[model samples]
Target chain A: MTLAAASHGFLSPTGVEIAFVLVGIATLGAALQTVTSRQLVHAALWLVVALGGVAVEYLLLTAEFIAWVQVLIYVGSVVVLLLFGLMLTKAPIGPSPDADSGNRWAALTVAGASAAALVWVVVDAFRATWIDLDGTVQGSAEVSGRSLFRFWVLPFEALSVLLLAALVGAIVLSRRGGDAKGAAETSAPAAGEERH
Target chain B: MHLAYPAVLAVLLFCTGLYGVLARRNAILVLMSVELMLNAVNLNLVAFDVWLRDALHGGQALTLFTIAVAAAEIGIGLAIVLLVYRNRGSSDIDRLRDLAERPAGPAGAAGSREAQPDTGAEATA
Candidate 1:
């Protein structure tokens, strides 16, 4: 019964596929806005929308655990971190000219070419492939947890260590300039004195 | 759902990120674009995992790992950008061309005229 529908060509669209397309369009639109907006802060805000749309796509794909994580980590924390970075850099409050670099046309050409090539290859490769969502849930939190602990325990532990290293590195990199400033303040002039 | 939908969506999103990375002047915006690219890959992973239904669920697990790594990357990236901003007074990539071969000097008009002949001499040689 289901096998016949699985073989149905492009004309037969399913409910989930329709929803996925809608959300995907919204997500791509937000992503475009994020990149092109002149207002710096607005770009960050648009990023939140794009990330949230990706989360919804995850939900449509039935990966419940990943969807929530995407919400919590990307839309929640990463966007906030980006906002903080923007403010710390003293980015302009409103639109200022020169938001894009001079090489954008070149970039556009390259990106467009790659996108064309990649989309052609991907669509040609997977034209008839259909994902069957009828069986037992694949991405429930319980299933992901069991698999993480059982088959993926080693890499999971290693990731924790990498997180720790990054935490310490961020702190050290952020705080590094203060001590060097005073020493450089004294030695810089001394070195100039020697040079002259 | 047909696999081509997610695959094509991911391709488009990745290209958008690639454009952002190339075209954006601000470091933070570039980081946002990188996040977009990574999320596109995550969507691909989740979609294929569901399709394959791996007994070990490698696709979904890798997605979790990717999310974590992305979080760490954003943290470290922001820190570095902040440090660069403090040192350079602006986070604009175009202005931070210390390593460029162009010899634009501090003394505006006279400097470039002097530099032009030297570069021209070098170029011809």
Candidate 2:
């Protein structure tokens, strides 16, 4: 479907666009801080903000289910997992001077160059494209569930298998690591009992 | 809304993740950045799925899959990192560069050998 570019000028900003731009700005800033923050925990906190902003964006795009999933999976669990990992790894509570690697400037330059090129290409390629969000609710839980089960069931099942493998792999990796041989040996019978 | 909005946002977020993966000293921080990059791609998928109005909603399905995969990736990645830290006594990526080809001869090799037992003993203790 060819949307009329002449009618939808860039100057004519709709309410959705304005909201999107504002939230997009906040999301981008939060993302910047997530990468650049000197304090490790602060970076994870900033990541929450960024991911939440993306969830908000999903809501704005009328993807209600995706938005909620984004929140539940990302904000609710992923960030918490990251925090636990940080603590388990004995991350410093205060700011650490060496949080950044030695190639910071090089990384910045590479990121900047790629961002510039990608932004230019995207803006240029999609200048005429418009998203018609006023029509059917494209991403309601009902719609998402129907499509996910109908057409994507195979992959969904495969994904469950993948997740299970990851689960077992993680357990064994941490359990049988050289550092915890005695613990793993003791836990073996317990694991076997649990399996039954 | 113009598709460019989400597209540009995804691009910037991906690049932010690129920098993080490149510049972070901590293993967990690198994983966080990887999540950022994956989230950015999900945003793009959602936006385009909405724009194209795909009948099967392939983009959204793929997004869900990507998110699940990312979760799995993080779990496995953290497990690996924790194992490394247990063995090496540090989670700093740069310091864990034992695979790097060093020009130094037996001195460096002997030094690494000497340090191994100490780290192993510390880990067991």
Best by TM-score: 2
Q: What share of the true interface contacts does each candidate keep?
A: 0.84, 0.79
What lDDT score is found at residue A190 in candidate 2?
42
- TM-scores of the candidates are 0.88, 0.88
Query: lDDT (0-100) at residue A4 of candidate 1?
Result: 41
Residue B17 in model 1: lDDT: 95
Clashing pairs in model 1, backbone N/Cα/C closer than 3 A = none
Candidate 2: Cα lDDT at B88? 60
The TM-score each candidate achieves on chain A is: 0.90, 0.89
User: How good is chain A of candidate 1, measured by TM-score?
Assistant: 0.90
- Top lDDT prediction, candidate number: 2
Q: What TM value does model 1 have? A: 0.88
Encode model 1's per-residue lDDT on A1-196: one tens digit a residue.
2574467668868888899999999999999999999999999999999999999998888899999999999988999999999998889999968789999999999999999999999998887688888778888899989999999999999999999999998998887435664476464444222322
